[model samples]
Target: MLRELPRIFVNIAGYRDTELPWTIKDLFEKARHPERVFAGICRQYAPGEDDDAAPDGVFAEQCRVYDVHAKDSLGVCWARHQTQKLWRGEEYAFQIDSHMRFVVDWDEVLLDMLGECDSARPVLTTYPVPYTPPDKLDSPVLPVMFARFFDNDDIVSFGSRISLPEDAPEKPQPSAFVAAGFLFGPSKLIADVPYDPRIYFQGEETNLAVRLWTHGWDFFTPNKVVCYHDFSKRPERPRHWEDKVDWRRLNTVSKTRLHHLLGMEKNGDPEALKGIENFGLGARRTLAEYEAFSGIDYKRRLINGKPGRIADLPAGSPERKADRKRRFTFIKESNGWGCEETASGGGSTMAQTEAIRRDLPGVFDSLNIRILGDAGCGDLNWISHITGGLQAYLGFDIVDSLINEAREKFYDRRNHFFSQVDIVIDALPECDAIICRDCLTHLDHQEILPALKLFKESGSRYLFATTHFLGKNTEIKTGGWFPIDLTAAPFNLPKPLITISEEAPNSTKSLGAWKISDLL
Candidate 1:
């Protein structure tokens, strides 16, 4: 009894490339088990002009082709989506451009590298080393994705740079972005996160990376070079945008669909985005979790190299756990939290804070709370409008700048005070009730208990904090984001004495009031 070799489904989207034939030849010639390698091509070419694009002999027999007129082609992603439809229940999915050269035993190399990843669902992807025409490949250096710039359409575009030999990790390194040209992962990725045919071109990689991550697929770049992409072919090749007349209209609609899917466009017309629900983000994780893991903030159009959360490390590895704690400590030493003047983030926006704004004052009066403490008050955005009746209002935040600005802005109001405090370890002031909104969700699991203990040690009788009624509580790195349910297992907090709905559009978020002792 012998074990069978895994089947690999190779997806190539050819848009009038003359190199397609040679690419197929190289693919078959370099694989150790050629019989297990299956190619699926979406060939977009003019009727009589691209006879060479078709596979010949053994290549033809092993491949499945879907032909389309080059003029009718939507875009690369559209063609890739069509190519995915030809999959025949293979074990792995390997996607690459039509013009590529391969290393010897590249299929086996990729499978071996993927096996080294710590995650159960690992996706290996990167921009391949570039090659010139015929047979010339550039120096064999790994290319890793980086946030290049924000395009005019407000979507983040990624660029790649050679990983320095001294800096590149020995194993596959955790990656935050995906390369559309080269991606290799399990066949389950095809079923769980299929490419959106509606996306035209620009937002394809970001869209795929986000959806794959949210669906519980971890990404890593290969430690060894497996293939070379023809970078010089683009100038000579015929692109879909050049051949199609309505390319602009198609691109616009595609970008809008991407924006809505990423939650960047909260006010977009629902009628214009009819079928986007079928291609939205996954339920295993939230968009906010992706933003925290990757430092690319979609809403703010900002890319900070400082990562908030580290990827999941293996459990019971004491050194790795210590390193994780050190990485989180580095964040606090480098800088305090950031907040915008009008809105801090999704949690603190005016729209999401409306319900709490309308109900907090009445609740304060009912509790007979004259002295109030605001734990983790960020920039005093909407909270300033609700503090009219308090005899004294004290605001605390980790960021010194926000605290200083708050003091200067309300200098005329004698009863208002601001101070910088670290809620996890610092001593807290005595107040009737402590309002800790939009704070606990950002702390690491280990830190949350200490923060709760600190709050309990404070003389405050009542605690009002943000809690999500929907979804199970998930852990994140120190500066990350997630909808934390206080009543869940880890916290085991009792039901709130009173709940004020935040009216969040995506989830059931509310300001839940609890006794400080119940939080621990």
Candidate 2:
């Protein structure tokens, strides 16, 4: 960074090591202006090593080295605190690991690239394509463009990259996983979402992502390569987990802190909650909104654009289903998820809710009802009529735009509320009866069964779902009401009460109803 930029101050946080000053001395002399570069280092000295071991010279003018007693070493967080305390409020900042190499003009290019962002508060990061075998510096690899997710024992998520894009754009791609090794953004933003001293290391990235996103900060990957990380010397470097203590036990404690902040560990995890009490969420959005926007359901550790839960992918050969998310494919080909509903189109919801209010008093007046894949409360008023006498009512949908609109237009928080989509993975609050509209038909067959099983497991004694199964032989057209067989694989609903021949509501062309006991 010093070689590339004329006025960049470097913060080299060293813990349990004595080589930081020696390393900074070399870089300080090589930098364009030695006075501009400030090194805030936390060094642990050997027993006989002198505190002023760093030779006083021109480079010493810009160094603020801390003598953290070697015997007092606790974790990397303590070292980080010492390093960050040297902050004098610069405009922009870049946090990187000690072992890394940079491309030519990286600093200048990165600063200019920040101007290409679409958001007022943008953070630039990525798992930069590897640059290995120092001798083979010319070998080119593109930055990770696409994000793929996998769960980490419900602790957090793991991200993998798709093949590099052939034709890359000049601007950075918006990213959800904040690469801790390489992050570039405004100094205040970093200060706002600073590292938590309680968390050692395992869950720092996730914690940063949640805090930044909720604070209305957006993240993106630099289309151009800013720098490359050298992974060859990981063992040679000092790590927080290297101490003699039970690191595994510490990691378990860290996971609890992560789950609590994400709102996943609801029952208990008070210790975790207290760890993050000082670092609160920003005013821009909620964690659920962040999950919906990024398409990474933290509760489920699943992502968008993959054949995962809640992704309504199509039925075909594995070739078509591979690496594709149902919602992305549909929205790409058509206007959007074909589930948009207005008052006129959702007339059936009125009829259905009224029937429940009139025909099923014992169930409607006392039981809690959860409507999955509730597109929009097109029948909000009518549904409220039935739910008014009921114990409670909750509606959830995948399309967040519709959910947000419906939540604002109708439903009081005291009794009736709607939330984000979590169909196939995260368990919903238990309900007495689940009133699912024609939503099953929208899911990939692989997801339908798990979804049904999850709904049944929600303590729902009765299931009144209107989605249907195709007959023995039939070709189904997608993007509208299509052939979705709920009885096919995992879910074998005995048979519908009666296959309603009547034309269905907006999201679907036709539909039917099924009961919970029938499915069992």
Candidate 3:
């Protein structure tokens, strides 16, 4: 049985009957998880007017609701409720907007995540918003959305879209930062770092995050965990309110204040505080005050440590540029055709050329010949058509009526002929060399393994083939095969003696080749 750990205490603020998508009663009915204990502090506009009915109906006698509202007592009431919850020794606490929905098994996710960290460390989690992108508006209501900005517990950087680094491993890593809407941490941590009442709304998270980061708290976001927020469900307001309040300005102010408190601003120069200013109000003030308090001159620091601009740094620094260079070399070596218009297309053509080129030197030196698939409309067969004097044979699979008619009318049966194409282990011919270009990608995954096995058993001394490497979100085309595995192996049998080239081509006809033997 899974261990029943400490329960999660959720503090939902600003939740009202009309503001919620459905009544809070309906929301909790779906959230009736046995492991979690629910408690709500609903503020009422009038005294002795109990709003406890909502929690009573939703929790079904499982939780408690307190009506702590009085005249001008909103902030104090929330503070008191938070204090009381902490006093009760709740293990984990979250302050959330009422409209957010829980999609995943939070208990299992949190348990698995927390187990990966030290017990002494703090826990902070953010929900993924599912409805941010306009394109998704037409789709079914998804439970998660992609965040465009980068988030860290200490600092929130907006505007830039997130992407994996070029050198990133196959799997994604934990993010260094995250937003606060769905923040999480140990109950004691929250108790120790109480929200500063001075912050009405804007800079509260910024201030808290700066303090946490300064104190050496490790912060991260799980790559896969997600949640959805109902941004559209917020209370309606009067027109021109956006211009009057200038929420963006408020954000700038809070960010500036937090930066100031964290001592991030050292000098009067604005560049040091640019990120904050760009974010909005609290940011500028925070940096200004932080500079004043820390007595760290920003101008002096800037002069002492001049960070290089991104453009000035060597291309793709922090990762060796060799991989890209290797890819280019392979392209130039492989592609013999030069007709393509773009560098990438040209490179691809060259890569194909190089694959044949590598084997050419050995074959020419030995005065031996090789055979490739027949010269049909398929581009690869052109090699056999062009090399008139070379001892190369063309093998055609003319099953289609149109192709058979074209073949019969075109008068070239002397050099090329249709043959039975079989991929089983027993049907292939023993040869000194063979080539199968751009054919693997058309086979099914099931056919690939067996075909490779048969190729190995063909007794061919050398074989060459072109296959694809898997990329993100790539799908198999209808009636086409996706590669089973890209790695060279006994699975990719009858492996060629010569190096396979995978490079960008320059054109339709000229594939450059570099002998790996030359590198030796």
Q: What would the per-residue lDDT of candidate 1 be over residues 1-520, giving only the tens digit for each residue?
A: 1129899999999999888888999999999888899999999999788777666656677799998989878899889999999999999999999989999999899999999988999999999998986779888888888775454466675777787646767789898899988999999999998888888987999999999999999999888889999876244566676566677677788888888887778865565476777777888988899988988878766667432122222222333334434433323332223323342454566766788888999999898888889888866778889886689999987766567778999998888999977776677877888998988887766666667778889978899988987647886755667888888868778899999988767778889998776665
Using lDDT as the measure, the top candidate is 1
Encode model 3's per-residue lDDT on 217-293: one tens digit a residue: 44545443434555552223111112223433433444455545555544433533444432232322244443243
Local distance difference test values of all predictions, in order:
0.80, 0.56, 0.40
| TM-scores for every candidate against the unseen true structure | 0.58, 0.51, 0.39
Angstrom error at residue 73, model 1:
1.3
Order the numbered candidates by lDDT, best leading: 1, 2, 3
Structure candidate 2, residue pairs in collision? 305-325
Q: Which stretches of candidate 1 lie over 4 Å from their true place?
A: 1-3, 164-168, 269-272, 305-520
Cα displacement (Å) at residue 264, model 1:
1.4
**Across residues 1-520, which tens digit of lDDT does each residue of candidate 2 receive?**
5445434445555554333444454445444345555666666544465344343454676666676665565455546656677767656666654444565555566677888998899888876555453323434455663334332234343454544445667677777768776777776775777676666565677787888989888998777766555555333334444432454455566667777778777755566456576676777889888888777676665667353431233333232233223332323223232223433134344554454445444444443333322322333545555555455567765544445666776646566677765465546666666666555555545545567777767765566665444533132222234555555444556666544343434423233445555666
Candidates 2 and 3 compared: the better one by TM-score is: 2
lDDT of 2 at 216: 85
RMSD of 3: 20.3
Q: How displaced is residue 35 in candidate 2, in Å?
A: 4.8
**Which candidate model has the greater lDDT, 2 or 3?**
2
